[model samples]
Target: MTDFQTAARAATVAMRDVFPATPLLRNAHLSDRFDADIWLKREDLSPVRSYKLRGAFNAMRKRPEVPLYVCASAGNHAQGVAFMCRHFGVNGVIFMPVTTPQQKIQKTRMFGGDAVEIRLTGDYFDDTLRAAQTYCAETKGYFLSPFDDEDVIEGQASVAVEIEEQLGRLPDHIIIPVGGGGLSAGAISYFGNGTQYSFVEPLGGACLRAALKAGRPVKLDKVNTFADGAAVGQIGARTFARLRDVGLANALTIPEDRLCTTMLDMLNVEGIVLEPAGALAVDALKDLGQSIRGRTVVCVTSGGNFDFERLPEVKERAQRFSGVKKYFILRLPQRPGALKDFLGLLGPEDDIARFEYLKKSARNFGSVLIGIETTDAANFATFFAKLDTNGFTYQDITDDEVLAQFLI
Candidate 1:
C-alpha cells in the first residue's frame, strides 16, 4: 500500500473510537436504473451528517494540547468542527456569515453546546473567514481550515480507506463531490491510479475545474449558494496542489436546478434526504450513463443536513428543470370578457399557481405575471401554441434570472 493508503487506514481505525465508519451500502435503486452495480458511501450518515467530522476529529485528536479552536463555515464543516470541539473538550469559536440560514447556525450551536461560541460576523463567507483567521492569529487559537490542512486531508482520506475495506476491493469507478477539493484530493491520494474517478461539482462553484484550467486557484466572480455545503468560491491552495493533475474530462459540473431534481428523486423515491451538495455524486450518473453501464460504481453522498423548510424551493427548482413549471408575463387586453376568453385556453393538467397584474391601470392592456404548472413539458408547447393562435403576447420569464429574482 502507498504511504497515503497507510495513513488513511490508520485514520479510519482511529475514527471508530469517535463514530462507526459510515455505511457503504449497495444501492439497488441506482444499480437497477443505471444497469450497473452501484454502491453509495453514505457519508451523510456520519455523526455530523457529513464526512467533514472525520477530518475535524482527526485534526483535533492530533492537537490534544490545544485549548482553543477557531473556524469559519456556514454549513456542514461548521457543524463538524463544533461536534469535534465538544467531543474533545476544547473551546471553539465558530464564525459564520450573517446571511447563513438560521437552521445551520442553530445546528452548529446545538452540536458545539457550551464548548463552542457562535459568532455571526460578515455578510459573506469570505468576510467571516477573514474575521476568524484574524481572531485566531491574535488570540493564538488553532485555526482549523475546512480543507486546506494536511491533517484534515489525512482525516478525509479515511473515507477511501473505509470504502476499500467495506467493498473488499476497489470499484471500477469512484464518483466524488468536490467543493474546496479536500475530499477529492484525499481520495485521489489514497486510490492513486487504481480506479477510474469522476469529480462532480456544483456548476456555480466549480473552483476545482477553474483551478485546473488556470493552473492555480482563482476566485470566482460569483457563486450560487443553493448547494451551500459545496459553494466554495476558490479551491484551497493545499488541496489544489494535490488535485492539479486531475483530468478536465473527469470533472463534471452540475447545474443548480438540475441538482434539485436529483435531490428530490433521492428523497421521494429512495427516502434519502440529501443536501444539494450530497446529491452531486449521484446526479453525475445521469451524465455518465453509457460510461458506467457495466461497471461497479461508487458514489459518495457527502452530506444530508437538508433543512425541511427548503422543500418547497427544492421542488420548485426541480419542476422548472424538468420543464413542467414556468413563469411568464402576459400582455392581456383590459376588458371584462378578456379574462373569460383566456380561461378557455387552459388544458386539463394546467394549473395556475400565481396570477398578478403588473399593470392594472393600463387603459387598453394589462401586464399579467403568471406561474403555470403542468403535467409534462409538452403541455407548455401546446399551451403556447394556443396562445399564439389566439394572438396573445407573452414573454417566458422563467429563465430570466434577474427578473425572476426580483419578481418571483
Candidate 2:
C-alpha cells in the first residue's frame, strides 16, 4: 500500500478511541429511486456530527509534543477541534467570528469543556482567521488548519479507509461534497485511479470548480452562506494540490435553492436531517442519472449540525426551486371587485400564501404583491394562463433576485 493509504489506515485505527467509524448504510429510498446501489457514508452520524473530527483528531495527535493548538472556524471545524482537545486533554484555543450563531458557539464550548478556550473576534471569518493566527504566533502555539495541513488530509482519508473496509470492496463511484477540498482530496489521493469520483460544490461557493478552471485557487467574489458547511471562498492550497487535476467534467455545482429540495426530501422521506452541505452529494444523484444506474455508488453525507430555526427558510427555498411556490406583483384595477376577480384565477390546487396592496388607495390601478403555493409545478402554468385569459397584468418576481429580496 502507498504511504498515504498506510497513514490513513493508522489514523482510522486511532479514531476508535474517540468515536466509532461512522455508518456506511445502504439508502434504500435513494437506491430504489436511482435504480442503483446507493450507500451513504454517514459522516453526519459522527460524534461531532461531521467528519471534521477525523481531520482535527489526526492532526492534533501527530503534534503530541506541542503544548497548545489553535484554529479558526465558524462551524464544524471548531467543534471538531474542541472535541479533540478534550479527548487528548490538550489546551486548545478556538477562534470564531463574532457573528457565528449562538448554538454553534455553545456546542464548541460544550465539546471542549475546560480543555479549550473560545475566543470570539472579528465580524467575518477572514478577520477571525487573522486574529487566531496572530494569537498562535504570539503564544508559540501550533496552528492546526481545518483542511490545508498534510496531517489533516491524511486524517480525512480515514473516511475512505472506513468506506472500503465497511463495503468489503471499492464502490464504482464516490460522490464527495467539496468545501476547502480536504475530504474529496484525501479520498481521491487514497483511491488514486482505482475509483471514479464526482466532486460537488455549492453553486454560490464553488471554490473547487473555480480553482480547477483557473489552474490555481482564486477567491470568489461572493459566497452564499446558506450552506455554511461548504461556503468556502477559496480551496485550500494543500488540498487543491491533490485535487487540481480532477478536471471540470467530473465537478458539479449544485444550485443553492435546488439543494434545499434534497435536504427536505431526506428529512421528510428518509427521516434524515442534513445540512445544506451534507445534502450536496445526494443532490448530485439527480444530475448523475444514467451514469450511475445499476452501479454501486457511495455519497458522503458530510454533516448534520443544522439549526431548526432555518427550517422556514429552507422550506421557502425548496418550494421556490421546485416551482411549487412563486411571488408576483400584479396591477389590479382599484375597484371593489378587483381582488375577487384576481382570486377567481387561482386553480383548485393553488393557495394564496400572501396578498397585500402596495398602496392602500390608488387613482386607477393598485400594485398587489402576492405569493402563491401549489401542489404541482404544472399548476402554475394553468394559473398563469387563467390570469392571461382574464387580462390581468402581472410580473413574476419569484426568480427576480433583487426584486424578491426587496419586495418579498
Candidate 3:
C-alpha cells in the first residue's frame, strides 16, 4: 500500500477502538427519487456527530508526547477535540467564537469534562484561530488544525478505507461536501481516479473551486455562514495541494437557501436529520440529473449537528428556494379600503407570513413590507396578476437582502 493508504488503514484500526465505523448504508429513498442507486457514508453518526473526530483522534494518537493540545472551532471540530481530549486524558484548550450557539458550547463541555478548557474568544473564526495559535505557542501546546494539517488529512482518509471495506469495492461516483477540503483531499487520495468524484460546496463557501481556479488557496472577501459547519472563507493550503488539480467542471456549488430544501426533505421524508452542510451532496444530485442515473453513487452525509431552534429558519429558506414564499414591498394608497381590497385578492393557499408597515415613502402612499407563503409556487403568479389588475404598485423584495434583513 502507498504511504497515505497505509496511514489511513492504521487510523481506521485505531478508530475502531474508540467507536465503530460510521455506516455505509444504501439510501432507498434517494435511490427511487434519482433513479440511481444511492449510498450514504454516514459520518454524521460519528461520536462527535461529524468526521472531525477521526482527524482529532489520529493526530492526537500519533503524538503521545504532546500532553497539551489546542484548537479553535465553534462547532464540530471543537466537540471532536474535546471528546478526544477526554479519551486520551490530555489537557486541551479550545477557543470558540463568543457568538457560538449555547447548545454547541454545552455539548463540547460535556464531551471534554475536565480534560478541556473552553475559551470564548473572537467574534469570528479567523480571530479565534489566531488567538488559539498564539496561546498554544506560548504554552507549548500542540495546536490541532481543523483541516490544514497533513496528519489530519491522513486521518480523514480513513473514511474512504471504511467505504471500501464496507462496500467491498469502489463506488462509481462519490459526492463529497467541501469546506476547507480536508475530507475531499483525503477521500480523493484513497479512492484516486478509480472512482468519480463530485465535490459539492455551499455557493457561498466554494473555496475549493476558487483554489482550483487560482492554482492556490485564496481567501474569499465574504463568506455566508448559514451552513457554519462548511462555511470556510478559504481552502487550507495542505488541502489545496491535494485538491488543486480537480477540474472546475467536477465541482458543484449549492446555493445556501437551496440547501434548506434538501435538509427539510431529508428530515420530513426520510426522518434523517441533516445540517445544511450535511445536505449539500444530496442537494447536488438534483443538479447532476440523469447524468448519474443507474450508477452506484455514494453521497457523504457529512454532519448532523443541527440545532432544532433553527428549524424555522430552515423552513423559511426551503420555502424561498421552492418559490412558494416571497416578500414584497407594496406602495399602498391612502384610501381606507385599499388594504381590505388587497387582502381579498389572495388565493386560499396563500398565507401572509409577515406584514409590517414601514415609514411613509410618499405623500399619498405608504410602504408596506409583506411576506407571503403559499402551498404552490404558482400561487405567486396568480397573486401578482391580481396585484397588477388592481393597480397596486409593488416590488418583490424577497431577494432584496438589505430590505429582507430588516423586515423578514
Clashes of each: 0, 0, 0
Best by TM-score: 1
> What would the per-residue lDDT of candidate 3 be over residues 261-294, giving only the tens digit for each residue?
9999999998999988999989999999898899
Q: How high is the CA lDDT of each candidate model?
A: 0.94, 0.94, 0.92
Better of 1 and 2 by TM-score: 1
Q: lDDT by residue for model 2 over 48-74, one digit each (tens)?
A: 999999999898888889889999999
Model 1: residues >4 Å from true position, as ranges?
none
| Candidate 3: clashing residue pairs, number | 0
Backbone clashes in candidate 1 total 0
Candidate 1's C-alpha lDDT? Answer: 0.94
TM-scores for candidates 1 onward, in order: 0.99, 0.98, 0.98
Comparison by lDDT, 2 against 3, better one: 2
C-alpha displacement of 314 in model 3, angstroms? 0.6
